[model samples]
Target: MVAAAILASAPATAALSADGGVAQPARPFQFTVIGHPFRATSDENLLRRSITEANQDKPAFIVATGIKAQTEACSDRLYAQRRDILDGSPRPLVLLPAGSDWAGCRNSAGRSNAIERLNRVREVFYPDNQSLGVRRITLTRLSANVKFRSYAENAYWEQGGVLFATLNIPDNNNHYLPEAGRNSEYEDRLVANRAWLHRLFLMAQRRNMEGLVLFTDGDIKAHVDEGFSLLSGFSAKQDGYAAVRKQVRAFAEKYQGKVLLVDSQGEPKATPAITWRGNLGRLGVGGEWETVRVQPGTASLFSLKDADSP
Candidate 1:
């Protein structure tokens, strides 16, 4: 097992305040890439081995993408993680939502039929969204068991130099979007989400941090137009996907920074898919999630290895 200790510690990035105040930034640490841990059920021991193996080889902070459950048992897996893995570790566990989490609960209609499941998740992980940051939870081994902040489509918060903002976007399956016959509830949700995202990004710019992280449960490739790229025609379009994509792109370009777009609803890789995680906007991803090394204000969409200090 290659589960070596910490390689190095450095500042990821930093920013400034409008009033000439120096700003805080993200902590510098190696980020480990782990695909959806939620799918590895009925085989806890095997799953644990696989997870530890991946971690030992990569030695990254846990990025549990698309780790959802078809049944309520999912929450148990999440809770058990604390005892099974994260108890004494200082490394953080970061996550984005995936359709199998709740969107897959829908029947043929593609509606969120997983209300019970959703409620259970919310209860277990987030009886309070204010602390959860959408579905992205950050658990540090500090006091109070670490209340990881949660944001809507766009909400921003800072931790050990790193700032995290999340987007609770509608599922690519259009499950969250209102149907032709529905009431205006979704409309209200849309307006709220839009305003929230804008505010979060703008704040990051104002603080002169590094860049903002925009996390969603769905795949960014899914937001692209049909036949967006030839290699994997699996990318498709949905109702709000286009608009959100445009906004993210514009924000990054305007600030000359980067946006960290995460695909929470990842399927699996025939081979090792997430071995190399880096800036992927041009590859159809918006910004390099890994680049905002020290802070969001000075957000550079480049490689950390390209960083000057370390």
Candidate 2:
């Protein structure tokens, strides 16, 4: 297992202002986001290639949005292999779990083993308060809170006057289950997520951060106001992301800084794009990877470019 570092050796991107606010960097800083590097069971080579490409650009940090493909088995051996792969990054690398990481897991009896698998994922990927890589950065995990001790994967950090966080919203409909007594996992996690969002927004507001960026596997933007259907009666499928979306919208409305939501499970696009609605922006990254530049004090606080661009 990798050990935690008190602070990263990377150059300082942000500093504390005289007034105790977070000061912007002298210039814009860039970071890369790798969307589902392991797109297939045989994509280990692809994952390594993606990391090498991102490393060549020397971004402040790298965020890989998923560990394995849905078809991959959710087993300890596979998880260990992926963890080793992620640990090879020379730059600080933050990981966000995808639905395939846990949602469809099953036990020997063929029963849903999602919770057990999710915990195993947490144990492997988020055992400490630092990112995986040769150069590690400190992070604040939700598990620091005694009440939400199990959600170590929900982590947040700051860089260049921006607050970045990862939420456990998976691509499999937030892992919602329609069966009456089968939604305990989803319901419990929903509560934890709401509290985590509240804490993140409040921290950004207090620190006077320039912008807030969120990373997750699911496209929360696609589920805004996605209401329930009456046709299916009590068993009707509900929008698992509704509560979190509502919270994000409310927080963004009250926040003075820009809000960017990034996810990996969006439709594959020829070019990565970000759609804006007032201060709120939604970026659905597809293809291999996307790099976003954060320019503090600019009208458009953030800008996106394909990682493959020259």
Candidate 3:
């Protein structure tokens, strides 16, 4: 069956109370997250199989983190092919960009072509406010704001009383360059991401959401230093994720609902795990596809399940 038909037949999350004057808490809902599936250029089959498997499970939607593998050439043809594959998915599929998708890109002349490649990627994948799949969902892109008009990839939507958003933080050290005066791309994106995060948090708060879920290519907490750096005295290696980490911590402190950050860069493991720090939680999907079941009104708002688990 097509994704739309399947989704239509799925159980509803919210229902009216016995009095018919108030609504009961939303029931649990599942969504699939496909980690970096393509390890090489020839791994297209792997991606196809992942999508097929995800469809069988019939999650509300599917989020594929990263389009192409590091080994894949940063070519327009490849990007187009991958976009077509995602568009074929029966489920609503959201694509998140990874460092491999464009950060390391180079022109034939051996000069950095990262910015151009990233723009091309955006044009190919984010053609509209809807996801790339047979079944679609409307998204609120950061580009809606005039100041951040170029960031269509950063978007958010509400599902099952939860706020779901995507931040374009690539895995290669957040795509930070050590060289001075050459970080226009990284710096600009950081600013836009901060603004997007603030907006997402404010919206969730205003709407009294059960929780806020963020999807990104890199783990924001992976390289963050919580304590003083002893090696370089008070100074530390330039960590691109520092700002985001700090912002998340501050926001989570005041927010009454749980905050979950999901990323694709983790070590390969049989089962994925979520580590919690107070109200903030982090889940790394690694190199395998995983599904998260979000249960409202539970002590743990979210739980991880293998994609193929029955």
Candidate 4:
């Protein structure tokens, strides 16, 4: 079955609820979101095993972040195959792109050009202007909320009462402003991307998402640092990246309790009453880093471990 055919199977429902509401109550929702399955060339079956492992629990939703559908060489085929598996599964699947998967960087080989590679990726992933080009194979589209194609780098949608928005922050796969030239155009584009990111956040806030889930496949505070140096070494897009940092901090500050960052291999930082180490590696994807602050009406949900695992 083709990707679109799979999603076209779901029939729309129309009904009224208590107080004459159209939307129904959301059931308990859960899913595993995996990152950077970069076609897993050298890792020798990392994609199959890690993905199979993460799906072990059979959660209601399975989100595969950063699946590059760009290259006919690597992820292109894999992305299609992943759709087949998820379509066959008993749950809904969503794909969000990260740095490498978005075709924003140079190839695994340093020789490949960025714009050309990204063009290829754009061709495969967002083909047909993100309207008719979703690589979905034999899946049904949900009426209330569903995405037909992989959303362009930064994408937003709500599932089961949870509002999820993804922002694109690619390494350009080591591709930056022409090393020495520091072209102003590239910087301008970077600035534009950052603005789009802040706008996405605003959209999320407007949605009044009770549970805001932010997914990124980069190193967030890769190591532990206690100060603004948490954002050090970001010299090229220092201003741009710093702008992103400020927005992230603002989110953390405003919704200090509801925000959750899901990083696959990252060890989260320590904050006063707001740090929790994840045990997702226990299930897979190392799970997530939940805030430590204990606020009213919030569950003291603790699944993360601290630095000391023993």
Best model per TM-score: 3
Writing each residue's lDDT as its tens digit, candidate 2 over 1-54 gives 011111111222456679999854446677888888655455788788888888
Spell out the clash pairs found in candidate 2: none
Q: On residues 1-310, what C-alpha lDDT tens digit does candidate 4 reach at each position?
A: 0000000011134335678877543454445565455433434244455455655555445555554433434445654654444334344445545555534445566654555544444455443312111232222112112231322545555654455555445534222443566444345445654555565456555754445555655434412232444334655244334445555655545542245555443332322122323211111132221221112122334233242225
Winner on TM-score (2 vs 3): 3
User: Model 2: what TM-score?
Assistant: 0.86
Q: After superposition, how far is residue 16 of candidate 3 from its true place, in Å?
A: 10
How many residue pairs clash in each candidate at the backbone level?
Answer: 37, 0, 0, 16
The candidate with the higher lDDT, 2 or 4, is 2
In model 4, the Cα lDDT at residue 305 comes to: 27
TM-scores of the models, in the order given: 0.57, 0.86, 0.87, 0.58
| Tens digits of per-residue lDDT for model 1, 201-281 | 676667553444555655545334443542344333334454555565556556533445555443443211221122223
Instruction: Identify the superior model by TM-score, candidate 1 or candidate 3.
Output: 3
lDDT for position 72 in model 3: 73
Report the C-alpha lDDT of model 3 over 1-310, residue by residue, as the tens digit.
1111001111233445688765856676778888887544457888898899888877889999888887678999999999999999999999998889999899989999999999999999997899989999998899888999889899898887789999999887788787999899999998999999899999988877878889998887822347733234424458777777778889988887778888987567535667778767777776667766666655433444442236
